[model samples]
Structure formats: structure tokens, C-alpha cells
Target: MKFDPNSNLVYSTDTGRISPSQVEKVIPEGDGIIRIHKESKGRKGKGVSVIKGLALDEKNLKTLAQKLKKQCGCGGTVKDFNIEIQTDNRELLKSLLEKLNYTVKLAGG
Candidate 1:
């Protein structure tokens, strides 16, 4: 038989029980401050507002992203615990987030 490095024995008689590898969800931690910034590096000069430092679960983050997008009348998405709104209006986003009682700050130049 050929050796397969990618395959692992799930169980063996001598070992009795073998557990498979577990995948863990990564949660982002912040300093209780929400930051909004503009980025246009890879999107062919199309700017996007990136909101970070939100200490919420994935579901809540999505919900918040939806609300913000709706209120801003724009499109956005939640990725890696950050919200990416397809707009360059950081001030509007900052005000909206502040109205929701989140400590907001404008980051980057």
C-alpha cells in the first residue's frame, strides 16, 4: 500500500478511541471602540468603508451590517468580524454608529 500523509486513522483497536481534528471559530476582540476607515487598494479605486473593533458574534455582526447598509442606502458585507460597506462616506457611518451608542472613531487618512 502507498503511504498517504493526508490520511489519518480515525480509530484503532489498540488506541480504543481517536478524535478528529476540530475547527474553532475565531472571535475578534477590541478595545470597546469602533473604527471606520476608507480603503481603495485592490478594488480598482472603488473606495469601501471598513468598520472594525466590533465585539459581536457573527450573526449579530451580519444583522448590524444589514441595518447600516439599509440606513446608508448602500451595499455592505461582514467579513472576519469586520463590516465592509461599499461607500466612501465615513462621516455618515460614524454618525450612524454613534447614534446606536457605539463609541465610534474615524481612522486612517
Candidate 2:
């Protein structure tokens, strides 16, 4: 078989698809403060504590979310780099975050 330098390899029987090079994940930069707020806007009056401004990546965020949920004894999730806990205990969240050396502030009403 003659090797062509200008030829591009699209696929091969050994490999199902030729994927592009992996791109680095870009984490959003945050200020030196984390905000904990209560949001019940679209949740039909069931408020959830939203924690934002953490400078951690997705995996770390999820880990932190799990820890927070365990500590709060409630369910939560990490969405868009923000932690949403199914509880209105923003004070508990603030204290927990502060214990971890994060500057947390209660935002919103």
C-alpha cells in the first residue's frame, strides 16, 4: 500500500470513529467570595439553597455537592458549577462552607 502524506484518516475497522483531540475543560473564574441564596422561583414554592462562585471544576464541584448534601441530610445536585441543595438552610450551608475556608455570603431574600 502506498502512503499518501496528504490523505486524512476518517475511520478504520479497528477504531469505530476517529475523534478529534480532546479539548481542555475550561472552568469559569470566580471572585474570592461564594454566595448562598434561596431560590423558589420555578420550584413551586419549594425553595432550594443555591451556592455559587466556587472556583472548583465539575468533578470537585460534584464531590463538594455530595459532601454538602450529606452534611445537610438532604438531596442536592451540581448544575452549571453551582450547588443546589433541597433545603432552605442557607445558614447551615454558609457555616459549612466557612468551615472549609470559603468566604460565603447569603444572597437574595
Candidate 3:
């Protein structure tokens, strides 16, 4: 039999095997600060720009993500209180956030 690596995931021994969790939501404090960074790991050397530390709730955050994605002309999403644009768009994102009145900071060198 072919061993399936993903066939054995358990939430708990008593609870038996379970699927992954997707409803995990992060609520960010509205501190009016934002951070942008570039990440390439686990993406086949393709760098993605991540914008985090935004002070917005889920609804507004999603709206903002859509706007940024549209402006960047790329796909993106809001996850774990962070906004991830599919490509390295740090400079553009920073300008956008600044225009939105967010105190933007570039993260990492």
C-alpha cells in the first residue's frame, strides 16, 4: 500500500483524526501603524510582499486588500492580520498605505 503522508492528522487522540483549521482569525489592534516586507521562502524563489501591523478589522481589512491588489495588478489576500500581495510590491504598497494615512515602515533589509 502506498503510504499517504497526509492521512494521519489528529486534533486530539480522544477526538480522533480531523481536518485542518481554517476559521482562525486574527484581530489586529487599530494602532494606525503598518509594516511591509518581502518574503521568498517556500514560494519557489518567487518573492511576495507582505504588509502587516495594520489597524483594521476583518471587513475593512479585506476591502483594503482588494484595493491594494487591484492597484498592484496582482492577486493578494488577508491572512493572520497580515496582507500578502503575490509579488514584491513593497514600494508601491508603502505609498498606497501612506496615502491611506497609515504610518508605513519597511521591514527587513
Candidate 4:
């Protein structure tokens, strides 16, 4: 495929021009849920609930938390493998995370 320098469309060598298709693909095996955690005093200090079963060093949780804070107009931070928002807005968090391709659940902490 090749595109003109100033244009946003592209062309294929064999197909000539390609038309954009609005196809939606369904993804499986994405049923993992995010758990909302409560703050606790651990050996280090105050710890909070965050999404579980994710990579130990990944920053997706932090990014999700930050985005939610902005959307909810609340203050929050990401730490200890989780994102802690200032408000206990579970429903809002769920919807927001789902939009970001996460399955969410309350951990009951």
C-alpha cells in the first residue's frame, strides 16, 4: 500500500484503490474483571485497591485511573497495582473501564 504525501488515503498495488470498511470484530477471552480495592496499612504504609491479575509492572491501571479522574472530575492516584479515585463512584468507574476494554467488579473491600 502507498499513500500520497499530502493525502490521507492509500492505494494498493493490485487492488488500485481501497475503500474503508466499518467492520467490527468481536474479541474473546476478555472476561477478566477489575476489582476495586480498599486502602490498607501494610508494612510500607497505606495501600489501596487496584485491578488484580494484571502484569506487575504494567501502567495500564495507572492510565485508566488517571483517565477516570478526569472524566469524573475527581482526584485520584495509581499505586500498588491499582488506581484509587477519590470518589466511590463504582458505577461510573465500571462504565468507563468497560469503554477502555476492561471488565470491572467490586472486590467488597
lDDT of each structure? Answer: 0.90, 0.89, 0.82, 0.61
Cα lDDT of model 2 by residue, 1-108, tens digit: 898798555666877656455335577788889999899999989999999899999989999999999999999998988899999989999999999999988899
Model 1, residue pairs in steric clash: none
Candidate 2 regions with alpha-carbon error over 4 angstroms: 1-25
Best by lDDT: 1
lDDT minimum window of 10 residues, candidate 1: 16-25
Candidate with the larger TM-score of 2 and 3: 2
Off-target runs (Cα >4 Å) in candidate 3 are: 1-26
User: Model 3 lDDT vs. the true structure?
Assistant: 0.82
TM-score of each: 0.79, 0.77, 0.72, 0.52
Clashes of each: 0, 0, 0, 2
lDDT of 3 at 80: 79
Query: What pairs collide in candidate 3?
Result: none
In candidate 4, which residue ranges exceed 4 Å CA deviation?
1-31, 38-59
Q: How does model 3 score by TM-score?
A: 0.72
